[model samples]
Target: MSSVHVEPVIAGAARETWLGGSLKAFREDPLALLCELHRASGDVAKFRLGPKKLYAVFNPDMLKEIMVTKAEAFCKGGTFAEIKRLTGEGLVLSEGELHKKQRRLIQPKLTRSHINRYAEQMVASTLAHLETWGDGQERDLAVDMMKITFDIIARTMFSYDSKHAQDQIARAFDSINHIATRKIRALVKLPLFIPTNENREYIQALRVLDDTVYGLIRQRKAESSLEREDLLSVLMRATDESSQEGMSDEQLRDEIMSMFLAGHETTAHSLTWTYDYILQNPNVEEKLMNEWKHVLNGRRPTVNDYPALTYTQNVIWETLRLRPSGYVTSRTALQDVEIGSLQLIKGDTVMISPYPLHTSERYFDDPLTFRPERFEQDRMKELPQMAYFPFGAGPRSCVGQHFAMLEMVLILASIGQQYRIKRSSTQGALIPEALLTLSPKGGLRATVHRL
Candidate 1:
């Protein structure tokens, strides 16, 4: 009998050489590496991101294989583990039967009809917050954008944010997001020292978030009723499987944590870039403003107002292309797969970088240029379906994509209807921090002038 030697399935096998300067070139501009990899290493390539090494696959067929055909073999990978500390086993991190059951229970409540009914709440909250802004003053839209979305999610999801709750949650969100956007996820296991003020602050802020979310879950249980209109009330009353058991206290806490964390942060970053782009590209801003003015006619926008707001939607979509909040998404390899020439092992990490794909020369013309017209329905046939996935692609895509996009477009239109913005020389265009999300470093400062 011949002895068999099997190759181990891991990062080492995929990368197969000394870490070298290849690792550093990768960390700074993985998207650039992806472009080179496509040309030099074929469609699939191996590289490193700090200590966490990876294989990047850009082929659409291979992408479908991992994200769809054999999704079960690959898990959520390392990032989800970091997020798990915050959201626990909620939808964002849970797998198997638990994930399926949770999705079923939550699906009805987030239906188009349900979300549309509360569209007014979303529009109202957005307008109310924007109204308070003073014209002819400098502001950081990144911070303000999140503040409003936090308020909207509070109203739409929980149905209320007591003055105290709002203050506490926002403060906690600031501390948590600020750190999460800058801190190195690989260092999460390191001991926390008091001298490490940033780490100390991060841990303290998470505690605050836990308390706030837990208290709300308790309150919802005590007060949940069929008559309530808010999402929290609906979630509290939701039943699983046989429709007898409502969410457990632990489950509810995790769900709320997922919402609290994901609700506003990414949307805020996208909106911030949208503002910067609209200001820098005056022609696009003018066209968007014209649409808003014609549609609104000085009246506040509501959910019913969405269809008439086509240009606004286009602007939002285009902004996401240029400054995607989560620039790259990843999946762990499950089965042996060959994408181009590189053969991937079961445990290898594969990157589907939106930045490179969105800006790829083969997929897009002058990928560096900003062009909102690319999304016009008539032009849809020009681009590949999987090429433009800012929210993501396949079953594992962000569930709240519609909700987030709705919030962003409506808020941008409402605010743009009343104000004009210019990039602040003092603040400059923000360079994003490569942490959990693509966050605007410092903040997105712009001069706000009343329209």
Candidate 2:
């Protein structure tokens, strides 16, 4: 541990104000504001929301202390507390013992062996969706990727095959995403019971989401004797160590909803960004095509084929590095602890933004350029730990990382092998919007052609 300084005068004090210093700017454009703070004040900077103190740590070593070494001293706070309305007490939102137990039960289902079983379904679902697109057709690749990933998650998680069911789930999630965006940026926190239009829409979306998830739970329970390989089955059969009991109906709903939201949205946005970058960089696109042709040779990608698709994997990694959907994550200190030189008091908040870190010149060469080659093994090994955590780090890191990677690689390979996508003439420069996830501002418009 580095020697700590006690009660150091917080840097970036000039950025504060009488009423929530930097709060307005943060709400407007968090990424830009945080980046400015980093540039002006170096690695560790402190500001305030009224009297409440907040710290933004940009150094990877300090971030590791918060996420790994002394993670137990922190709890999910700020945005995560707000997200509980949508995720309930599922693994993503839970803390302490509950989080540990939920993670324990759910972890087995997301292991590589379990996720590998879904690879065929992932490719098949992607191909089925691609088949609906006509050659030379213009489409919003962002929207298309969302639908494709949603369908794949639906099938692999619950054996849900109905287009109607998939559409309903997608629509509900859309509403939820919108509400989350509003809530996160709203100057005044509105109570859900106020019956505002946004509140009404949020409730309605939750109703639809609940109906679909609970219906699946009931249907599964009715056929308990049947053997299934889907995630729902594994979760239903899992028993806690102490109680030897599986999750209740409501518990199942929470876990299923968490997986559905976390599983698809990030992966979809990542794929969308990947396509956006590939269209902008011709050389990268050519390399990706060459890799696809040489590896699978026109055959659709299977789980076995992913190991050979090195460039395709690198493309996904670079996309995540450049445009991580979960761009920033927050945690509140549960105890007074020393992080590097500063003393953090209990209840003080810490914000770790991967967006700025990924683009920092100190961490990477030519940070803004779209160069997938930076992810090459030797180069990657040279970078600092926690410097590139799109899925986060430590205990609360994304549980479905393997599943997401496989799905993205297979989807890219399958689509790239059959189609060449280019930006539409009407589409403008990519402007990233920091909503619930970092999505392209107006969606990614592109034209697709069969190769």
Candidate 3:
């Protein structure tokens, strides 16, 4: 009998020949490497990150299969594990039954009805932040955006408005975000118990955040009889339908930290890029301004104006496509599964990046160009659902999507109504540095022009 030779289905094959597989390429420029791989391999591309196997899924159908249809088979693991260190068992990191229960409990707070109540506060916060800006004065919109979003989240969610407390929380959160981003991709990671300088700093940052969050929770608990409109108050009052149980203090802390990160960082990055792209494309700004004029008519935008503000919403959509806050999200296979022709065994990691898909020539005409008209009603109807999901899709989709959309629209409208931000001559091109959230590197310096 002749000896039979068979090649392994997925393990040994690698697109790159380097010792570290795609890690070296990914480390250099993650977005570029993923885009290259998608172009070369089509929907599904198998590669390695160090010793781990990763499948880059580019097609809408394949993405749907992983994120929606077979979502249970692919759990939030790997990179999320790193984030869990900061967020604990919050909605973003929790898995299985715990995740479902948490979602059920939190869903009501983010409902459109509840989110509508926050509209006035969102615009007020933006206007308040704009007071710090001067006409013709150069300012970093990145910092300004962060400050405004942070202020909004603080006032709307926690009902905490002390500037000193907000500043302390902001500083500690920034420290944690910086250290967590560095540690997420590091080849070697030391445990928290280890007394390394980096570990010490990370722990201290965690301590500051915990202290602040715990203080808020305690204050809310003491004021249980007092009815409030804030999210924290709602969450404190929330009870599970099945168990009739409320969240614990630790659970509250985790969810608060998750909210602080998600509610602020992502929207701030989106607005910063919105201005960057708007400044780069004068036509876009003109259209946006025209839409605001027609819709709002010199009045501040209300939640009711969203349907009328089509072009303004379109600009936000286009910006999200070009620069998504959650640029690349991943999941690990919990069991053997067949995604098209590829057989992914248990523990295999699948990366689905909207960046490559959004920028691809196949799905978009002149993909590199910034044209918000592509999202017009007729055009958008023809596009696939998975092709443009800035807030993500499926059961694991962002629960705060409604809240975020309304807040972004209000802020953008409020800012554009009073001022036009142009890039400063001293600042170079805006560069994206993919941290926990995709943020503009070196901040976005621009001059505020009063209308």
Q: Which candidate wins on TM-score? A: 2
Error of 3 at 116 (Å): 1.1
- Candidate 3 backbone clash number: 0
Candidate 1, residue 275: how far the Cα is off, in Å: 0.5
Model 3: runs farther than 4 Å from truth?
Answer: 1-19, 224-226, 240-244
Q: Which residue pairs in model 2 clash with each other?
A: none
Candidate 1 residue lDDT tens string, 136-224:
88887877887788888777888756445666676777776656544433323554565588778878888888888888877766763
TM-score, prediction 2: 0.94
Count clashing pairs, candidate 1. 0
Enumerate clash totals for all models, in the order shown.
Answer: 0, 0, 0
Q: Model 2, 1-451: lDDT tens per residue?
A: 1111112112232466687777777766777788788888888888765555788999989999999999999998865766777788898888999899888877888899889999999999999998899999999998899889988999998898747777777788888887887787665789889989988989999999899889988888899464797878888888888789878888888888888889898899899888887887788888888888888888988999878888888888888887888888888999999988878899889988997788888988777777788877768778788788899999999999999999999998889888888899999877777878887777899999998
Alpha-carbon deviation at 44 in model 2, angstroms: 0.8
Question: lDDT score, residue 187, model 1?
Answer: 29
Q: Rate the local accuracy (lDDT) of all candidates.
A: 0.71, 0.83, 0.81
User: For model 1, where is the 10-residue window of minimal lDDT?
Assistant: 1-10
